[model samples]
Target: MSSIIVTNIAPTITEQQISEFFSFCGKISTISLDHNTAAADKSLVAKITFAKKEAAETALLLHDTKLGPTSVVVEADPTAPAPAATADDAADGELRQEDKPRSAIMAEILSYGYALSDKATQKSVEFDQKNGVSTKFHSFLKDVDDKLKVRERASATDEKYNVTGHLHDTKSTLSRYFEKALDNSTGSKIRAFYADSSKHANDVHKEARRLADMRTGKSPADTPEPELASSAPVSV
Candidate 1:
């Protein structure tokens, strides 16, 4: 009945690992790892629902605990009610507030691309200041630069297509554009950015549709899977 939000989970961590880590506190009913929430950040956000409220409170003590090399942020999940729809949303026939116009969505996506690029750059600078730009910092800088490059491409693509206003319902066209943009890049990091961005967009579309379905009473709410029975430590 109680849920906790776990943020800054290392990309190397898996659902099984998270389940086992939290199982030590008490019975875990479900664990939902939402990588799509902030794909560009190279982090995972998980919603851990405990069978008992006390268990959730217990798990909160793990806040700032090291999940991998980096510490994680854990807090009680704020189950805020969905926002009320405006007259414009009603006129647009959008059942949920998240179902915005295609151009609006693209604009938001572009903003996220820029924000993530800036975040990576800032982190790299901070790391260099702290570590004096060691070999590890060089590698980190390279990774951040690669991510920024891909995000720039994604932002450009989104802006171009947003002007054209033709990407609303055409997944194939979007895929083709992404492919053409990434054709010259052979690095794994670049490929990962492309994949993650595409997946994130698709997930947003799917969730919007799901919310519409729920509003019409056509589909039931998504249920989280039961926790797996595993106590083994998560492999990095």
Candidate 2:
């Protein structure tokens, strides 16, 4: 009951800014941002859980007003696990309508388009351990456009984000691990992970490059995805 949802946030807004903005409500237990990459605007949404119930109440008071730069809508999280709910409440089917369940990568994608934090890097490893991650990344790339195309016209596009930089950095990090040992030959799980991760990296980078071209008036064909500082050929 101490959670609230903040919507229509800018992608560039950081967790620190979100925390500071909501500090008036008291200690915050967690802050998570959600992004819709397929959305033309690519605005972010955040779910914050306050340590104290009253704190969330205090923040919800500012709902509908632009109390912070990134937040446009602040509302109660009716779906938060209630401390105690009567069996009658359950029988009545009093619940939030979850039109879409969140995916494991929901919190991960927003980490890109910016510098890689330790948390983001760690999350990458966590994703590797989770099942169906490669498929999810593939789907993400498809939404991003498999060819890594940037469909957003220059006029309709907002300010350019350094998506290429982040992807490049992430791939470089992956390459190092992929090349960590010469013994990691074909059929190695690590090798497969690297191959899949690198492919997605390339997919994301292609879109980033195209977006860059659109913004700078460069011909899409004239530019290539930025080369990673370190890269390795995958056997898998």
Candidate 3:
């Protein structure tokens, strides 16, 4: 028996409907539908084993053919393991600092800066929560300084790389706005601002990492960021 895999099955499709549709081509020995339970975003896949290899070939020829409202992609089932990476692949993977694309490197640097800012904000929250009113002011000031340092580094890197003018202006404007807000904020407002900023910074970092990983072929295009460590309450 030979197998043909069909993908892009609509959610409304059923095993019986798939079986009936393929039965017109040839006798189906078995049918297996992979319902992705891990995530709701993924599409379903169906593996149809045909009694004759000729039937499987016939199905393969139906690639990109419509199977309802969507165009279904059909291909022969993989019978062998993927080939191991060769030396050339390894050589290409070891990218030097100068060899890396300027845009990618700039993105990576910006991500690092965002990560630093997030870390500072997180620490500020923890410090405020741990120490009473006596130390909260000091901690807030320290956090502001740390965040400004990160922003300064990112701006300098962007200037060195001659990044787009709009990006530079946007970053500078946001940084100044955030600084002014932090200076005026106190007590709960400070914490709230830091929390919101941290969340946004982490999101940007995650997107940068996702894009970098995709370019390097280290992960699938749809892969999510690895689980982050749980935030724990700090005690002084």
Q: Write down the RMSD of all candidates, one decimal each.
A: 21.8, 16.6, 20.4
* lDDT per model vs. reference: 0.44, 0.42, 0.45
lDDT of 2: 0.42
User: 2 or 3, which is superior by lDDT?
Assistant: 3
- TM-score of the candidate numbered 3? 0.32
* lDDT tens digits by residue: candidate 2, 64-182: 43433443677899889753331321133221111001111211222223222233233334434443333433433333332223333342233222233322223332222223211
Estimate, for each residue in 17-102, the C-alpha lDDT of model 3 and write its tens digit: 77755654445779999865653646679989876554464456445545556657778899723333323221432222222122
Writing each residue's lDDT as its tens digit, candidate 1 over 1-236 gives 67899999888999997886665444677898877465576899999887655456556655665665656787899992232432332243212212212212322222222111222223322332343422322343355446555665555434432213322233333343333334333234223432222223323323233223323333222312113122111111
Return whichever of 1 and 3 wins on TM-score. Answer: 1
Better of 2 and 3 by TM-score: 2
Q: After superposition, how far is residue 85 of candidate 1 from its true place, in Å?
A: 33
Q: Give the per-residue Cα lDDT of candidate 1 at 18.
A: 84
- Name the lDDT value of residue 121 in candidate 2: 33
**Cα lDDT for residue 105, model 2?**
24
Model 1 / residue 213 / CA error / Å:
55
